[model samples]
Target: MVISPQEEPSPLLREDDRETAVQRLQEAYADERVSHEEMEERLDQVLTAKTHSELASALASLPGENPDTTSTIAAAGGRIHRGGTWRVPRILKVESAYGRVDLDLSRAVIEHPAVDIELQLGTGGAKITVPRDAIVEVEGLHTGWKDLRYKPPRRARSGGPRIRISGAMGFGRLKIRHARR
Candidate 1:
């Protein structure tokens, strides 16, 4: 049976679905399937998409996503940096020993309503950058000889991701900051 556009199933797209679509669009743009202007336009639509059909339309002609993946990064006496238009995993574990880590999630495509970040900091420091609209909560944070510093979100956003960061820092600093627009 052929379904008309109006008759198509248009379930509401969850925040996670929208994020995934945005990530796919970004990948398409990077692969040159879509132009810069088209990517920006699709991204805007994805951010404001209200229904599954709308989100699907935004990612139309794009490549399919791979299976869900998790990432773990360990730094030993070196610097670990993750930035650019990468996909944010549902769970991320970072371990640093006498090294530094920088995780920038401003342009990341977050596929979950809540992202879990586990950090193991030792004589090293970490800097986490997130979107200004995201809600960030650092729990069970213990720092010795340093501090975990971040300005509490002024107000929680309805459809933004929540970053739950929990970890220990010894002789190191953990700073959570908003991304510069």
Candidate 2:
């Protein structure tokens, strides 16, 4: 069965979700986008997904975006990172040890209403989903970095929150699913 983005929690990811996430990750492995070791490492995270958004977020990081990928993830509670170029319809000035990061969220809704505002990292990726009508605001930077990529499954649309990459590391591929509606 297809799980709705809003149904997920945070922090602690569940195991059942791992089953579904593994299937999707396998597609990336098959495409040679990710190595077998990476797949296994990511799969371990998904299986432990406590929230649906976390599971979806993990899936977003996968290499491939095949239509046939099957994912069923469960979440308990924890943190999630949103990745992409930082930009928001409204600008929120943020400063920190890592650096200043801008949030571009004029077109986002919180997949989960009970959770805190969207958190961005300075040099990592994030994956978050919201309900159909909650406006997502920039709360703060969870972490930050350069070079972010997000690729979602065929049935999904919109990438999650955007993050600014430092561009220090060589170019790499990161897939983030912003929205799936």
Candidate 3:
């Protein structure tokens, strides 16, 4: 009744798996268990992981992640700002209704090389700041009578994080800019 490794079904790496690995790396970075360069390298591996084994290897040296991890911010008729040394989750979901949401990743600690941001903006604005070397990709954003402006990255460079933003912005503007540094 035992299944061989080849006969067993291989676990496909999913977005959630990548997120969990990144979260573990973030915690390790916070606990000083991994240096900045090591964190970045591990994050890259996590994002580009193709199989469950690869994903597991990314966080194998780190502590286990919380099974019930949540990294979502909802702003209803108010302002929500995330900046300054905050840990960037692997998949950050922001929901705003008649409010503003600002995310500054200039000095923030990013755990994933490819971060996915799910935004639901309504009659509100969002300003996101990332490092100059990072890559910003916006998708699935449809605005009505409003503007979503941002200087797209020239090209994806090696060893730089890629921010994949996907959401709907209604009558709200979303601006992505590079850090002043």
Of the pair 1 and 3, which is ahead by TM-score? 1
Order of the predicted models by lDDT, top scorer first = 1, 3, 2
What would the per-residue lDDT of candidate 1 be over residues 1-181, giving only the tens digit for each residue? 1112343333454465665667678678888878898889889988887765566567654544442565788867799887644567788888888888899886555667888899888887889998766788888778888878898767654556888998788888888987644
**Model 3 ranges with Cα > 4 A deviation:** 1-70, 153-157
Tens-digit lDDT string for candidate 2 (1-181):
0234443323344443455457657767888888878878777767665655556566554444432332222122232322221112222222122322322221222222222322223333333443222333333332233434444344533333333322221222223333333
- For model 2, the stretches where C-alpha displacement exceeds 4 angstroms are 1-17, 64-181
| Model 3: residue 97 alpha-carbon error in angstroms | 0.8
Candidate-wise lDDT, in order: 0.73, 0.38, 0.71
Better of 1 and 2 by TM-score: 1
Top-lDDT structure, candidate number: 1
Q: How far is candidate 2 from the true structure (C-alpha RMSD, Å)?
A: 16.1
| Structural similarity to truth (TM-score) of each candidate | 0.62, 0.30, 0.61
* lDDT (Cα) of model 2: 0.38
lDDT of 3 at 87: 53
In model 1, how many backbone clashes occur? Answer: 0
Error of 1 at 167 (Å): 1.4
